[model samples]
Target: MAQAYDPYTNVIHTMTKAMEIGHIDQSMFEILKNPQRETKVYLPIEMDDGSVRVFEGYRVQHSNIRGPFKGGIRYHQTCDLNEVKALATWMTLKCAVADIPYGGAKGGIQVDPGTLSERELRRLTRRYTFAIAPIIGADTDIPAPDVNTNPQTMAWVLDTYSQLKGHPCPGVVTGKPVELGGSRGRNSATGRGVVISAKLLLALEGKTLEGTTVAIQGMGNVGANAARIFYHRKAKVIAISDVSGGLYCEEGLDIDAISLYLNQGGKLLKDYGAPGVTHITNEEVLTCKCDVLVPAALENQITEANAGKLQCGCIVEAANGPTTEGADDVLEKRGITLIPDIFANSGGVIVSYFEWVQNIQELTWERDQVNEMLEKLMSKSFQELLNVTEECHCNFRMAAYIVALRKLVFAEKMKGIFP
Candidate 1:
């Protein structure tokens, strides 16, 4: 049997390795292991079918030394406190890696959104917002969208929070509709960042994103947007998947048609069919022969059990905690480069910082402006991570942790213990 995946443990394993490799941080070791705060709430919403349901929800703030608590609210059936804690920790590290003025936080409710009707979903989101309202704010803790939550969900959050505050508090949420002060390029920021990470890593070997055979393992906001962007950039997306299953094509699939089909109600790739396209299991998608393999799905997709089976030149994580610690060793031994999640998927939070800045100042930026700023920041951070990787003689994941831990520990040390 496969080992159970615990995101918190996974993060700690990487941090411990980084601490040993970096070899200068023992004072704050205990401080780095635990979250600063973990808030849980019971949300009761009236269902459309005349029933009331209560969902368990959580918001974990991992750190706030750098700035306010910043992260997304993910709604998945498997969402729990531990998962949120791990994601919150990554948010802290991700912001430090991106050099953003924000700490780490993540909120989520344990419920399958697909089973909720539109009205029920809206009520549940609003109630959850009300439940967590006391702990979240524009300058204290800003909530954004994540898996199963999107601009619409953020809109509800913003509206609910604003209603409570008795004013338009756009800064309280990051991924709301653009008309309501959302960032212009926030929708594709994470996906674009994944592609950017792949491009950056490939460039080290004198290669470009064009003509790269890519296989992505999720088709949600991040994976679908990534596939679209990669396709537009002339990358051959040989395989892609959603929660249902995966699809593959050796000569490169017609991304445009597949996207349109999925967007038009063919929600799962298991039902998506076309000429020359072959249906494959999600496992096949992960281990497919490709230049780049993107595990954009949920956590623990790549574990020691299948780590040696990955056939890609490199792996770019679009999701949080996609690769396990044991898998890290396996991939390293196999000579496959894996871009750490903290650095690879930091784009969402980076642009989210931009959105928060704009909302606070009542200003907006053009798409090109946001996109350019995002690329510059992610690339600069990537360069720094690469430098640390070389200097420490460590893998990308550990190097990223060392870089982030240095910043976090230094801040904590300077701030000193609070009374």
Candidate 2:
């Protein structure tokens, strides 16, 4: 049997390795290793069936030294406090690496949204929001959407918080609908950022986006949009998958058609029949022959069990902690260029920062402006991470951790301990 996965342990492992490699101060390591605050709440919601179900939720503020705590709120059955803690810590590192003026925080409710109707989901979200409202705010901590949540979910959060304050407080949340003050490019920012990172990494090897074979695991917002963007960029999206299964074609799958099918609420790739499209299992999609493999599905998708089987030339983590430490060792031994999640999939938060700015300033920028700003931030950070990797003789993941940890620790030292 495979070893039990602990997301928080993976995070601390990476942090300790990066600190040792960077030769940072031990005291700083002690301070930067844990979240500043973690709150758990019980929300009792009245379901449409007239039954009362109490749900467990959490909000972890990893750090706020740079600015307000910034991260997304995920709703999934598997969302536990440890996972939230790890994600919150990653948010902090992601912001620092992206050079965004925000700290790191994460919130989640332990419930399978698929099991709840739209009405129940909304009620649960609202109740959970009210429960954690005291700790979250525009200038204190801002929550966006993550995993199973979307713009609509964010709207619910914004509305719930606003209702409590008895005023229109749009800044209380980001990733909301456009009419509600969401940034123009916020929807596809994470996917766009994934493609941007891939392009940057390829350019370093005298390559271009065109003619590259890519396989993305996960068909949600991040994975689907990433597949579409890469398809538009002339890359051969050989394989793609959802929770059900995957589809593959050596010559490249019709990304446009596949996207349309998925957008229509299609579930499994087995039902997505198209000419030349071959049915492939999720495992096959992960280990498929491709130039780039994007695991955007969930944490621990790529583990020691199959890490050595990954055939892609490069692995860009679109999901949080998709690859385990042991798996990372295998990839390093295999010389597969792996881009860390903190930097690779930060486009969403980067744009979320823009949305927060717009909400605070009560001003909205054009899509072109948002997209342009996003590219600059992602590309610049990519280059810096590349430099750190080369300078420290470490993998991209370690390099990113070193960069983020250094910034966070420096801030921690300057801030010092309160009396």
- The true-versus-predicted C-alpha distance at residue 183 of model 2, in Å, is 0.2
lDDT of each: 0.92, 0.92
Candidate 1 least-lDDT 10 residues:
263-272
Estimate the overall C-alpha local distance difference test score of candidate 2: 0.92
Cα TM-score of candidate 1: 0.99
Q: Model 2: runs farther than 4 Å from truth?
A: none
**How far is 143's C-alpha from truth in model 2 (Å)?**
0.2
lDDT of 2 by residue, 363-398 (tens): 989999998999998988988888888899998999
Q: For all the candidates, what are their Cα RMSDs to the real structure?
A: 0.9, 1.0
TM-score of 2: 0.98
